[model samples]
Target: MVEIKVKRHEPALIVPENPTKNETLELSDIDDQQGVRVQGAVIMSFKRRSNSIKGEDDPAKVIKEALAKTLHYYYPFAGRVRETGHHRKLVVDCNGEGVLFIEADANVTLNDIQTQIIPPCPLLDDLLFDVPGSTGIIDCPLLLFQVTRLTCGGHILAIRFNHTMCDMLGFMQFLYAMVELSRGAHKPSVMPVWQREVLCARDPPKVTYTHHEYEKGGDKSHEVMNKDESNIIVPGGFLFGPEEIKAIRNHLPSHLQHSYSTFELLCACVWKCRVKALQPDPEDTVQVSMTVSVRENNIILLPSGYYGNSFVSPAITTKAKNLMMSENSLLYALKLVKQSRNRANEEYVRSMMDLMVMEGRPKYKDHLSWMATNLTRKGLEFVDFGWGKPVYSGVPRGTSLVSTFTRFKNGKGQDVIAVVLCLPNEVLLRFQNELGKFVGDFSPLISPTSKL
Candidate 1:
């Protein structure tokens, strides 16, 4: 492994070029209250231009200029988040205090980092801006940007935003706006709509459906963040080529053939593999929790540009013994995932809101729970800023959340998927063995032809 070296430049504060007078922006229930516990970040790497290209500004200058101009519209990114209201709801304090911007130079190229799949931590962790506390929502910078230049003329762009401000969809939309401005566009492709009042609870606050994601349990024992090397889980990156996806589809039960989508099938395979890798007691119940978007299925319907957290994670639980049933365990798991996914409708969304209001949202700290999220079809890879689309992009390995990312289009125009997994080091070997059965004789390969 090459010792990756980085040189840090002075950090500058970037405020919106045109500031909005001091004001507070109330967040939607789903956006503000739900995600106040975690931070959302994306790391994207870009290649430097050739010397033959004439009159190109410094990449940092280009990014900073465009960011400044775009911040006028997305000014909330330049703000700080603070708690307000009797129920302790979060609101963005639109004070014109700027966001932190960092510029650094690395001794290695993007390929060097990519070759290692996920760069070593302290090194990987060094690439992004840091926040003080990871759990509670407090007065913190709503946005942070770091641009590290590589010796090979490539650069890594890492952006971190408070999850209370927006969801993945919302975050990508903001990025798209900045990219468009950098490429000399006068206006953004999609305008933002921040009508948090639209998501306010109804007058009566009715609960029409049951939400399985939450339960009545009070246990706050002050669990410290696990940082011990012996306790650290080895992160693994897996690729599911079209061929592998096809094999899994073919293996679906005869009666259920052609009914499962690629995402469902992949989730089923991983959920079961993880259960087996953990080797929990046979009689214990294990659960898979998946997040789904409610923008499309909401009864009242959010606006086209409503950028907020409009998703929910509904969990499905099954006995470890039953989940690993030799004959049709995978099929059975897929069935449960599909059934729980079907609950992302309007009534369910309403019920989730009401339940949170009535029960005062409890932190779901189940040791046996695994979270799976789908970022596959989102237009993250398509975000280009003149240099070209990213060779690779995804989140870092700091959490147990399993995310499926962008499907790049190969020369043959085939969709290639990447699965990012973080598991206990002890269980990784068994997880790989389980995954290999589906991808037979294949290994993790990086295809950088094109990003979606």
Candidate 2:
């Protein structure tokens, strides 16, 4: 067994004044769409400073001290979930569980925490981040802190947050404030903007959509869909190295008639590649859904700090068996994705909003669901809490039916895109092998022009 020094942070002292409860917002009055409820998850990594000289005190104690000081400035965070009569929000619960700390053995890796620890946590398993609890305030689903001793004689702290309450920008701001607190700083230059009223669903709401809209039928909803029973298969989530990502990008043709974004091009290529790798029936139709945010749709210009669950419209493209079997050009497939995205705009959103307002939610159907979103534009890299920059980040679990995409800044300063998908174990291995072949064959074509 690999022995390593380990330390744990004891729960903080709770004041009687604070109590755990749930916050409630009136969905009936505003838009009744279930998507209005926002839930967010973030993972941050921290490295220990090598030159720091502290006495013989336990390292866990030092880290807890740093966290305690940091929590003080963000005192509201220390409280538990509480519910008021109607309004649901985070209330100060003196007796709250506070933050959790687990010191893993040296053999434990970040992947272990993400896959093993995070998915099983009660808070995350319950999916309580969005639901209104008995407390008036929304509970911080599960704020996890995993400290691992790396082989290089340093430590890494991984923090994950639920997205219901905060966006990427808001979470980063809060993180920076925590860092300031750890440093014993009194004030952070950037204060948090707790403007929830602006993002709340409309009053006397014009639309009343429910979870039923995205379900196969009114019987089984998207939220309630059982992954084990559903035909929607997801492969294992894996991270790709720089060279691998470069090769995938190089597979796209440089001489295209219409210009296509990297995401659009790559998404198309990956979708087809995934289908081919799975050896799905050639007659089967594959549908690719891309999420389009309605923040700038002009219908509703959400305030800068608006942190509510906004609209995410899916743009879909379907390809038949013949097309999938006969299509060798990745660019051709990419055009389909590009066309689908360009077509879904303000008018499309308004029409959907009107339909949702008039008819409520729609039902999910049989289709191969795949999506890609750009996180690089969301300022994920800028989120530097006092512990330096995060070494790794991700949303560990939740949606297994659909594959999600995120882009991050790699060490080489290149945009590294990640695709998280789920599929059968055997299919997944085959997919990986196919990806390896595509990358190997494609890398040589782009190496001369590559920036890295």
Candidate 3:
């Protein structure tokens, strides 16, 4: 593999000459008290046919033109990152490569693409990729595009973006635009709205209520509760095949009066197994932290299609040693998870938002270390980059135990959901071993002959 560093000229930091044509999107408002900006990547792969024809439309040229034209539709996206004193927005950076395209051999899979594409991009390497501490960007564009030929005679297009700019829904919109462009469409169905001021945090922001009370200074402040001591990280990340997941789900007895959602069940099982594999003391408390969207929260019902960091809630749950040892059932554990998630009310979300605004942007590390997010169903599959459809897509590393779940369409026209989790290396291996044992005992439940 050839490693090349292409140093392009830095663009002058100038706001676009035309105001009416440009849109302003805010990143600071959506972030939490800790400036630990969220980062994400979208992967889409296509199968190549040996008999396929390469036409007058050069793939690279088509992609460039498509991106340019699509940017005109989502014009706000083309703006470069800008920080002015305390305010920031997407401005025109004529010198920065706001969007980049890298070409690699077809043999690259999603994993290979992530490795090759992220290193060369300075923005990704320095600012976004697996950042250890929180240093949120008011406006940072680290979009990566990799086109690789596959050994199977097809090509793949992978796009990665910082989550601060857009959410799953907005990201899908951007992707759909790219797909439309790839198909030679001059315009997208809907143009992007980049009016950041319109969605700014409320004046004198009133939402300040926290579920968990914080005591300033003292031993309480330094306490690290509910930390996972697992040494093995699951391999193949946290993704589980449809059959494997289904089997695990079916293992849950239906006799329990209260049932749990598939998500709750799966998370509980993973946590339980990981804890067991790690052999943490029975007294060790295990907690699960997951993110929830705040766009619909009553304190701030963001306008429809408003993109930025509108998410706030990070719910967590802990189990005592006695309970974990006596009732080791997955169903019981899932019930606890369900109850914990239910604690995230409008007030909890609003409190975080208020803190973010009041703190005036605390350093990033002060926040990210304690939280783990589950982004399993962030609408990634719906994103079409115009290459038929993506076979698989997601971010595999960086955050602690971050997970993404997607439904895949198989040849038989059946939909199967897959869960991908990224855990520490040792934790992952323990998870795999536990999963192996679970699968050994529960294979029949997941087989085609078994009822779902």
Candidate 4:
């Protein structure tokens, strides 16, 4: 392992460039759900720039200033999160308290990191730097960012924020606004909105439809928090390039070849492979939880600027025997995946909010479940920070059974989807063998990139 270390300095707060809101804002029912109450982060690593204008050279200064200005419009991010009443719903105390900011220097350069900066990045903990007390949900900093300067003059930008404040897409909106300011734009193209009340439980809220993913208590499959001991877990990345995708399609009937999508295929294949590898009971329930967008139908229900947790995670399940069947198992899994995803319409969105309240706001459960969230189409790979686009952009920490999809390139210089998968060390090989039956050279676990 490469020895990469960072030396940190005192932390500070960056308030809005201009004070504006002082009233508290209630969090949307979706945002307040126990699944999203924790802290999460996104990482973007950039190489030194040769094109930056003077005064724009230091990333920390540029980003910090841009952040304060960006916060003026998105002030909720500059506030703290607190629960109200015995119900435990959350609200943003828009006290203009500012966000956490830190600057640091890394002993190694970007090149040194690129050598091993694949998904499940080894440098995540050191790069993000989770400060003390920052993780508390009450009155804690809603947003935190760290800019680490490398010996090569490049830097790594890491951001931590309370998920209750916003989901990944919502946070991306805030990020782009800051990037605009870094480019000296007078104002963000899209202003922020805080209409959490838009998603509040309806009067006399009723569940109407059952939420499988939010089912009350789980079974023994979820007994262990992390996936067994660390030594038994194998976290790695897999690329789904054109060849790999085509090979997968070969397994489907011609009539269904183009019916399924990349995202659907990914969930189906991973879930199936994982089930086969785990060798769970033949009748054991195996599920793939997908984060589907409610925003498509939510455009009318939710205004344009509303970006809080606007999606729903619908868990689709089948018997392990069904998924591991000798024939047509992939098709079976795809059907479930599609149906589950399609259920996240506007009505589903409203119903989910109502169900959470009815269930008294339950926390996240992981029994017999695997999470698959897609960021590939989000265009995060193209997010530029003036220094240039990052070679690596994502988070590597989460439940061992959870995976995220991001855009990446293959050895052929072609676009592909990179998925970060975590499996037991004993089953990883078995899992890959199962997946290989559907894919042809899905690229290597790590690809050579010179974005630096």
Task: Report the number of clashing residue pairs per model.
Answer: 0, 47, 26, 0
For model 3, residues 319-359, the per-residue Cα lDDT tens digits are 44533463566776677667556666666655555555555
Q: Per-residue lDDT tens digits of candidate 2, residues 1-452?
A: 22233333332332212343333332221222334233345443444444544333333454556566555444444554443443332223434456655554354343333223222122232222222232222554334455555434334554554344444445555666655655666765565434445444333435322221243335443333345434654435544446665666676665652366656756776677677765656665556655555554444565653433344545554555633564466766776676555555544544454444344444333345455554545555554444455554554433434455555555577655555655655666666666666577433111112221
Evaluated with lDDT, which candidate comes out highest? 4
Q: What local distance difference test score does each model get? A: 0.70, 0.47, 0.48, 0.77
Q: Which of the predicted structures, 2 or 4, would earn the higher lDDT when compared with the native?
A: 4
User: Which of the predicted structures, 2 or 3, would earn the higher lDDT when compared with the native?
Assistant: 3
Candidate 4's TM-score: 0.91
Tens-place lDDT per residue, model 4, 69-188, is 999999888888888885688888889999999999888877777645556566777887878888887889988899999888888888888989887788888889888888989998
| 66 Cα displacement, candidate 4 (Å) | 0.7
Given candidate 1, what's the lDDT at residue 205? 76
- Number of the top TM-score candidate: 4
Whole-model alpha-carbon lDDT for candidate 3? 0.48
Candidate 1 regions off by >4 Å? Answer: 34-36, 50-55, 117-123, 131-136, 219-230, 254-257, 297-300, 401-404, 409-414, 443-452
